[model samples]
Target: MANRLQHETSPYLLQHADNPVDWYPWGEEALEAARTQDKPILLSIGYAACHWCHVMERESFENPDIAALMNQHFINIKVDREERPDLDTVYMAAAQMMTGQGGWPLTIFLMPDGKPFYAGTYFPPEDRSGMPGFPRVLLAVAEAYRNRRADLERAANDIQGHLTEHFRWSLPETAITPALLNEAASGLARQFDEANGGFGGAPKFPPPMALEFLLRYRLRTGSDTALRIVELTLERMARGGIHDQVGGGFHRYAVDATWLVPHFEKMLYDNALLARLYTLTYQATGHPFYAATALDTIEYVLREMTSPDGGFYSTQDADSEGEEGKFYVWTPEELEAVLGPEQAPIVARYYGVHPGGNFEGKSILHVPEAPESVAAAFDLTIDELVEIIGPAREKLYAARAQRVWPGRDEKILTDWNGLMLRALAQAAIALGRSDLRDAAVRNATFLHTHLYRDGRLLHSYKDGEAKITGYLADYASLIAGLLALYEATFDVRWIAWARDLTDRAIADFWDNEGGAFFDTSADDAPLVARPKDAFDSATPSGNSLMAESLLRLGLLLGEDDYRQRAMTVLERFAALAAKAPTGFGQLLCAADLALAEAHEIALVGDPQVPAMAEMLAVVQQPYLPHQVVALRHPDQDGEDEVIPLLAGRTARDGQPTAYVCRNYACRQPVTTAHDLAAELGMAVE
Candidate 1:
């Protein structure tokens, strides 16, 4: 029989609907059941794409005997971490505190109330490698709960106290400064693995936030070391198996130091963040590789992950056909079959495919030879080689289409879509891609139409249904995207929407006294404790994003209140951020903005005019991290609709004029693109 999860919206929950163990989606019903029955609640948190989650389900949850033991002793509840980040955050903290580590397929034994007493990650059905088996652990926990109720209750209470205390951080009064920024860069530089391109040892995750920080640091200080680190890391990652050669986009992370092997799951957030990082790298260094990679990654999203209504889907599963990476891996024989013998050898050699496969007797294609080297070895020109490889790649992709693809979690998450929207918007402006701009607008429109209703945003949307109240991350990230969209198109509507959203966020998620946004809102499902996310993890923290959104939006809207709140939040976390620079990459990026001697460029003209377009292009040309640009056109003529920066601006001699300002102090307006470039520190092309 199907469990309660049969009616649920989450793909993860639906995936486990037919498990032998009777599973309840995390809610009041399960909590009440546990309380009334006087049994502990076993909460298992995992996302749909988690490979180990599927493993545990097959081994333990599907077993009738094990299900009987679980059903008798505990109220089993499953949570899709992507849906309820509040629950996941609270319990993940407890798991980390208890086990000194935390990961997906998180197992927590809770009392009738939601306080976790015991926690762990994946457990095998049978005992192995010194880890307790799931059945044995379950029996022992149930016994302890029965025999030692008072003691277990006391321990649970203590754990709750510890978890609550974890969110209470000491606010240090420190100013953000360039010296501190340099210190943070220096700290990251020390941790950079010189042998490999990433930081620290094996199992390297792509640190997009850290890489972004390094890029900004290099831009500010003109440090070759910082630039080199960013360049090498990006180049190595693209060349490694962590990046898909036939397909585009990257896997979750590389499992080895050399980036030769990856975990193989594709997540929307990682690709979104990395695409923006790559786009910025291209703008900064004029590297063709970064531009090509960024475009390819964006194309991957457009092709595979996007929904018909324009919302980006969440994740692609790591496993297919009960085996990890089966769909993505290729044998030399298979390659030859797809590309004929003559072409197969060269293509295989170029992509590191050898007789002895790199991964489980099948090769994972990655760039192993340089274009120049491969071209020379093949006795062909570079253009000739690329021409041949291009057709060959298309053929391989078409053939690979015949394989069963990984399961896609088709939920549209507001925060994740916001990340991708920002990437698309910014990349459109940077790369002059009208198609990307149209897609960004479509995505924003989808969110505005479907997710945002009655001045409130919904967290997750699926099958034309929007569920879950928006979190701080949702508001903050979407506001950031809106701001990026405004910059990309210079549309005041996006900025106005961003302003309204920021105001609502302040009212909903802001801790006026504490000076940072909480992960959960006042109306969110009440948990053991509300968390203030301070670190940049798999995605950026809500607090850091809120800070950044306020900083950028405040400048564009001329809102002092938003800017002040942003400063307060930054100052509150300044000492902690300074102490742990590597962990606070997004916060550091915000600090970089807060401390920058920023420029406000108000371009007054019709956007369609040739001269005005040239001026706008110049302003967008250089990678100006600290400049905020706004457009005042004849079309937006209403008094109330005018932004503060563009209020008094006028076109000089009926030509498009640029008013460049430092902290609102304006210089004389310039008409020509050359003159505007001079004022804005860009070399005229």
Candidate 2:
């Protein structure tokens, strides 16, 4: 029989709906059931793409004996961590507090009133290798709850107190300066593994945020070391098995420091961030490698992750057909079958596909040799080699398509979609790709129509239904995307929508007393404590993104209030950011903007002018990290909305003119791109 989770929209929850164990979706009903029955809640939290989540579910949740034990002893509750990050955040913190580490599938034993007395990650069905089995832990927890109630209560109280204590910040404020950024750069340099081209040892996650910080630091201070760090890390990852060479996009973190073996799951957030990072690096250095990688990543998202309605899907699972990485790995025999013997060796040599594969007798394709070296060995030019490899890759991709593809979680998350949307919009401008612009606009339309309700936004959507109140991440990231969309298309409606969302977010999630945005809104369901995340993890923190959005929108809208709020957030988090600038990359970005020379480019003329393209091209060309551009068409009437940056700006001598303003001081308007570049201190090509 199906459990209560059958009705849930989260794919993770729906996956367990028919489990022999009766599972309740987290809600008032489940809470009431625990309270009424006086039984501890067995809360299991995991996401759809988590491989261990599937393992635990198959081994324990679906087993009849264990299901009977769970049903008789506890109120079983299942939660999709991706769908309800608020619950995940609060409980994950508690889990870490009690166990000293935390991961999913997160197992927690909660008291009747919703306090967790015990917490752990995955547990096997039977005790093995000194680890207690799930059944053993279950029996012990139930026994403890029944016989040693006071002890359990005391532990829960202590855990709750520690959770509260963790959120409070007491570090003294340090003024953000050039030296602090240098310190961050130096810190990253020390942590960097020069030989492997990543930070630290095994299990290497791509440091997209850290790379972003390094890029900005290089741009700001002309630090060659910082630029080298960014270059080496990106190039290493691009050539490593972590990147999908036959297809496009990257797998999740590499298990080895050399980036040779990845975890196999592809997340929307990681790709979105890495794509934008690559694009920015390309713009900053005019590097073809970065641009190509960015384009390929974007194409991968378009092909596999995009929804028919335009929103991006959540994730692609790590495992397929009950085997991890089965869908991605390839044997040399399979490669030869697809490419034939003659062409197979050349492609194999280039992609490191040996008979004894790098991963469990099946190759994860990667560039072990340089393209020039491979070309030299093949007695062909690099370009000629690439031409042959391209078609061969397509043939292999087609053959791989015949295999059982990995499961996809089609749930559209507002935060991840927002990040992707922002990436596409920014890449569209930098690469001048119309397709990317269209996709960004279409995605914005999807968010506007499906995820947004009457004057508010929902967090996740799937199968034509939107549910859950929007979190700070949803509001901040979506507004950031909308702001970028406005910049890309010069459509004021997007700017208007961004403003509206920002205002609503401030009302709903802003901590008036604490001075940073909360992860959950004030009116959200009560947890052990409200989450006010400040540090960036796999995704940028909501509070950090909120601060950045406010700053950019405030500058673009010429609203002092928004800027003031942003300053307050920066001030509140400055000390924490200074303590570890790399972890607070988003906040560091906002601080960089706050401290840099604020430049606004107001192009006063008809956007349709023949010269407008050249002027806009120049604006897009310079990697001006702190500049905001707004179009002020001369045809605007009183009825049309006006942005502050565009106010009192008009064309010079009846022609399209560009005004470069620094720190609110406008320079003489220039009619030509070259002249405008000179005014902005950019060398015209």
> What is each predicted model's overall lDDT from 0 to 1?
0.89, 0.89
Q: Report the CA-based lDDT of candidate 1 relative to the real structure.
A: 0.89
**Tens digit of per-residue lDDT, candidate 2, span 222-275:** 889888988999999999999999789989899999998999999999999999
Best by lDDT: 1
Query: Model 2 Cα displacement at 401 (Å)?
Result: 0.6
RMSD (Cα, Å) of candidate 1? 1.2
lDDT over C-alpha atoms for residue 321 of model 2: 97
Backbone clash total for model 2 is 0
- TM, every model: 0.98, 0.98
TM-score of 2: 0.98
- Candidate 1 on 1-685: residue-level lDDT in tens? 9999999989999999999889999888999999899999999999999999999999999999999999999999999999988889999999999899999899999999988899999999999999999999999999999999998899899999988778866566688788888888888899898877988888899999988888888888899999999999999999999898888999999999988899999999999999999999998988889989999999999999999989999999999999999988888899999999999988888888888799999999998768889889989899988988899999999999999999999999999999999999989989989899999999999999999988988999998899899998899889989988998888788988888888889998888767788888878777888888888888998889889888887777678888888888888886677668768889889999998888888998887899988988887856788889999877667523547888788878887899998767899999998998898776666
Off by over 4 Å in 2: 636-640
